[model samples]
Target: MDAQLGLRERKKARTRRAISEAAIALFLERGYDAVPVAEIAEAAEVSKRTLFAYFPTKDDLVLHRFADHEDEAARVVRARFAGETPLEALHRHQRAALERRDPITGLCDVPAVVAFHRLVAETPTLRSALLHYHARSVDALTSALLETTDGVAHQELTARLGASQVLTVLQELANTNQRRINEGRSADELASLALAEADHAFDLLRNGLAPYA
Candidate 1:
């Protein structure tokens, strides 16, 4: 029974990948807005109903790739090693991600990944959808922070504020990396600088901005 279930899940994953790949290929060829959902459904060889079942909205078709990362910050915080601060854990993760050329970190210069970034940047709907997704990510991180035994007054507000600042810093870091990549800088070329910037950013988060004043 477990084997059967595993096989079924693998099949579903393949189907989803097929649909996403087809949709992205078409979107890259002809602008995202110009490509219709029905066309994507047909290209994926799935019924429109099946496509909708897999991805509820057209925006989702593009953003589905990001779903796995929605709670990444929260997960990192929750899984931090004993005695490690949340900021430290997140900073370590960001460094590792950049080292691995993780697409989410904007350090990947793969043609497809670069194209994906371009698609999102150029599409208004995808940007709006991403903002909603970021909000959820911040909320998840806040909840994770609240779970930790960090004693402070107004815990909820502090958690939310901290999560917001951390995520925004990371987002801006990624945006900067992506901009440099888009300008033709290789990930290998930017590796040292990226790590340094990440260290500095996390230090500011850890130590507060009084140093800059």
Candidate 2:
């Protein structure tokens, strides 16, 4: 029974990947708005129903890769080691990801990845969808923050505010890197810039902005 379930899950994952790859290829070949679900389904050799089963909307086909990272901040907070604060855990996770130059973190300046960033930025609907995803991530992180703090007054409000700052910094870092890549900067150069940016951003979070208050 377990073997059958594993096989089924693998098959579903493969079908989803095929559908997403087909949609991206079609979108790149023509344009995002110009491509239809039917065309993508045909390209993937799947029925429209099957394609919709994997991805309810066409935009999802291109952006589904982002789903994994959506709750990453929350996950880090929840899984922090003993004696680690939520902010500390999040900063360490982000710094490690930057050191590794993770693509999902937008530290990668590869041409194809940069093109995809440009494509999403150029499309209004995709940009809105991306924003919505980020908003959801902020909400999740807020919940995690509330869970971590003990009996703190206005914990939910504080979490929401902190999550907003964290998300804003991350978004700015990603956009900056994307812009540099668009301007034909080298990945090594972008990595250096990102490391510096990450340091300053996390430092602000760590040292509290009380002086400005």
Candidate 3:
């Protein structure tokens, strides 16, 4: 019984990948908005019904990877070390991602990845969806922060404000990296810049924006 279930799972995964790959190929070939689900199904040699089963909406075909990252920031906060603050954990995670050159970090800097980022940026609908996903991330992090602090005095307000700051910083970092890539910057150059940016961004959060003595 387990073997049968495993086989079924593997088959489903394969089908999903095939459909996604086909959709991306078509979108890349002839702009995202111009491509239709029926065309993608034909390209993948599957019926439209099967394609819809894997991806409920056209946007999902392009943005599925992003949706996975939505909960990551919150997860990092929840699993932070006992001595680590949520801000510290999130900063460390961002720095580690930059070092590893994670594409999702918006430091892909590769032509293909940069093109994908540009494609999403150029599409209003995709941009709206992306912003919605970012809001979800902020909400998740807010809940995690509240949980971690256990409803201390003003915890709700603090959590909401902190999540907003964190999300804004991250969005700025991603946008900067994407712009650098669009301007033909090398990955190594972007990585170095991102490291410095991460330090400055996190330092502000750590120490607050009070005037220095």
Per-model TM-score versus the true fold: 0.97, 0.94, 0.93
In model 2, the runs with Cα more than 4 Å from the true position are 210-213
Residues 93-133 of candidate 3: C-alpha lDDT, one tens digit per residue: 99999998888778887777887888888888888888878
Q: Scored by Cα lDDT, where does model 1 land?
A: 0.93
Runs in model 1 with CA error above 4 Å? none
Better of 1 and 3 by lDDT: 1
For TM-score, candidate 1 versus 2, the one ahead is 1
In angstroms, how far off is 86's CA in candidate 3? Answer: 0.6
> Against the unseen true structure, what C-alpha lDDT does each candidate score?
0.93, 0.86, 0.87
Count of steric clashes across candidates, in order: 0, 0, 0
User: Highest TM-score among the candidates is held by which one?
Assistant: 1
Q: Which scores greater on lDDT, model 1 or model 2? A: 1
Instruction: Rank candidates by lDDT, best first.
Output: 1, 3, 2
Candidate 1: Cα lDDT at 88: 89
Winner on TM-score (1 vs 3): 1
